[model samples]
Target: MLKVQEIRELIKLVDQSSISEFVYEIDDAKIKLKKNTTVTTVEAKPAVQQVVVEEVAKPKAVEVQAVKQETKVEAVKEEVKKDETIDTSDLHKVTSPMVGTFYQAPSPDSDPYVQVGSKVSNETIVCIVEAMKLFNEIEAEVNGEIVEILVKDGQLVEYGQPLFLVKPE
Candidate 1:
C-alpha cells in the first residue's frame, strides 16, 4: 500500500506529464496513473515474503536434516569413487571456529557429531569442540554435503583447523 504522500506525488506526476500513462515504484508498492482516462484501476497485492527471515528453531531443523545427510553422502561417495580427487580437492571446507578438543559426539557413548555425506546448513551442529570444559557446539556455516571428516574423534584441535570438507549445494 502506498502512503498519502505517495498518492499525492502520483497525482502531481500525472498533472505535469504530457504522456497518457506514468508508473512509479517505491519499496513494495507500485503506483500507476493515467491522464484523460475515466476508468481507474485499484489493485491490492497480497502480502510479500520477507527477505530477512527469523528462524526460531534452526538448530533442531539442522539436527533433523542430519538424518538424511547419509544418503546424500552415499551419492557423493559413488561420484568420489569415480574420481577420488573430486571429493577433497575442489570441495569447500568447514574449519573449527575456535581452539578446543574436538569431539565427534556429545558423549563417548553417543554417535559422533556428523559423518561423511552429511548434508548441513548454517544452523546445523556439525560437532562439539570442548574448550576449558565448555562444550561448544560447532555449526555448519555453509549449506553443503560433508565429503570428509578431517580430524579424528576425541582429537585435540586448534583454532581454525579443517574439520569437514563440504560441497556447496
Candidate 2:
C-alpha cells in the first residue's frame, strides 16, 4: 500500500507528463490512474478476500460504460461527416491551435460568437478554445461567411482540427 503522500506525488507526476494512463501493482495491491478531459480518476484496490469479486465486476461495468460512450461519439462523427459532404475545396478552414474544449460562446448564457452564414474578417473572434484552464480566443483568419461549424460546443478538439468552414469573400 502506498502512503498518501506517495499517491499525491504520483498524481502530480502523471498530470505533468504526456502519458494518459498509468497502472502500478505489487503483491495484492493495485493502483490505476486515468486522465480524460482534464478529469483524473484514481483507483486503488487493496488486498482483501472480496478483491477478486470486485475486480471481476468492475471490468464489466467499465466495458459497458465505454461502449455507451463510443456509441455517442460515433453518432456525432456521422453527423459531422454528413455536414462535410458539401463542397469545401475553396473554403477556408478555421482550425484549433491546441488540444482543448471548443466553446462556441464566451459564457454558457451568451450567444455564440459566430454561426452559419455569419460574416467574419481576419480579426473576428469566432470561438474559444479552453486548454488547461485558459480560455483562448480563436479568430477567423479570412474574410468570409461561416458555411459550417465543424465541431459542437463543449466538444474536445485536437490540435489543428478544423473548427469551421468559411466561404471566402
Candidate 3:
C-alpha cells in the first residue's frame, strides 16, 4: 500500500505532466491517478478493491467511475462522432491555461467579465480560474466579439479546455 505522502507526491507529479491519466500495478495492488479541473484524485488499492481520494478545490465532491471494457469501446465511438460534428476553423477559442475552477465573475455578486456580444481585445481578462487557492485572470488573446461562454460559473475546467468562442474582428 502506498502512503499518504506518496500519493500526494504522485498527484503533484501527474498534475505537472501532460498525461491526463496514470495507472500503475505492483503485485496485487493498483494505483490510478486522474486529473480534472476542480479536483485531483488518486485511487490506490488491492486489485480486487477500490479506493478513491479526491482533493476538490471547491466545497463540492465529484465522483468518477471506471467503465467496463465494452462501454469504453462504445464511448470512444461516440466521442469520435461528436468530435467530427464540431467546426472551429474560423472561431477563436479562449482556452484555460491551467486546470481549475472556472469563475465567470471576480466575485459572486459582481458582473461577469464578458458575455455574448461583448467586444474584447487581446488583453481583456475574460474570466478567472482558481487553482490551488490562486485565482488566475484569463485573457482574451484574440481581438473579437464574444460568441459563447462554454463553461458555467464554478465549473471545473481542464487545462486547454475552451472557455469561450469568439468571432474575430
Candidate 4:
C-alpha cells in the first residue's frame, strides 16, 4: 500500500509541474497520480516547509472512520438510486469520449449534468470528465430521453464506456 505521504508527494509533483498525470509500478506498489485542478493552491502552499511540518497528524482511528463512512454513504446512495434504474428494455447507449474520472456534476455540491428521465437534445451536456486537469464536457450524441445512467458518478470510465442509455423520441 502507498503511504499517505507518498500519495501527497505524487499529487504535489503533478500540481507543481505541467505534467498532467504520472503512473508507475515498482514491485508490488503501483502509483497513479492525476492532477486535480481544484487542488492547485493547496499543493503550492508549502514548498519551503518540509511536508512533515505542515501536515496535520491525524489518528488512524479518525482516518479509517472517515474513509469507511464516506464509502458507506456512497454505497447507500447508490442503492437508493438503483431503485430508479431503468429497465434498459429499449435505450440507446451514449459512450464516453475519453478515458478519465466521470463526474455527473460540475462539482461535488452541485446538481448533476443529467438525471434519469431527463430530456436532452443533441447539444446537451451529458457529463463532464476531468482528465489531466481539464474538464471536458461531453455532449449527448443522440436526441432522446435519458432512460438510464450506465455509470455512477465519480466512477473511473474507460474510452467508449457507455454513460447514458437513452430512449429516442
Highest TM-score: which candidate? Answer: 2
Off by over 4 Å in 1: 1-89
lDDT for each residue of candidate 2 in 7-116, tens digit (9 for 90 to 100): 89998898899998898886666778886666665566754655343445345888899999999999999999898797989999999999999999999999999999
Each candidate structure's TM-score, on Cα atoms with residue i matched to residue i, is 0.48, 0.55, 0.51, 0.49
lDDT of 3 by residue, 65-164 (tens): 3345567889999999888754668999999999999999999999999999999999999999999999999999999999888899999999999999
lDDT of each: 0.81, 0.92, 0.87, 0.82
Better of 1 and 3 by TM-score: 3
Candidate 4: worst-modelled 10 consecutive residues by lDDT: 38-47
For each candidate, how many residue pairs have backbone atoms clashing (under 3 Å)?
3, 0, 0, 0
Find the candidate with the highest lDDT and give its number: 2
Q: How are the candidates ranked when ordered by TM-score, highest leading?
A: 2, 3, 4, 1
Q: Which stretches of candidate 2 lie above 4 Å from their native place?
A: 1-84
Selected candidate, larger TM-score, 2 vs 4: 2
The lDDT of model 2 is 0.92
Supply the TM-score for candidate 1: 0.48
TM-score of 3: 0.51
Model 4 lDDT, full chain set:
0.82
How do the residues 15-128 of candidate 4 rate in per-residue lDDT, one tens digit apiece? Answer: 789988777665556666666544332222222554555777777998999999999999999998998767777778888889999999989999998998899998999899
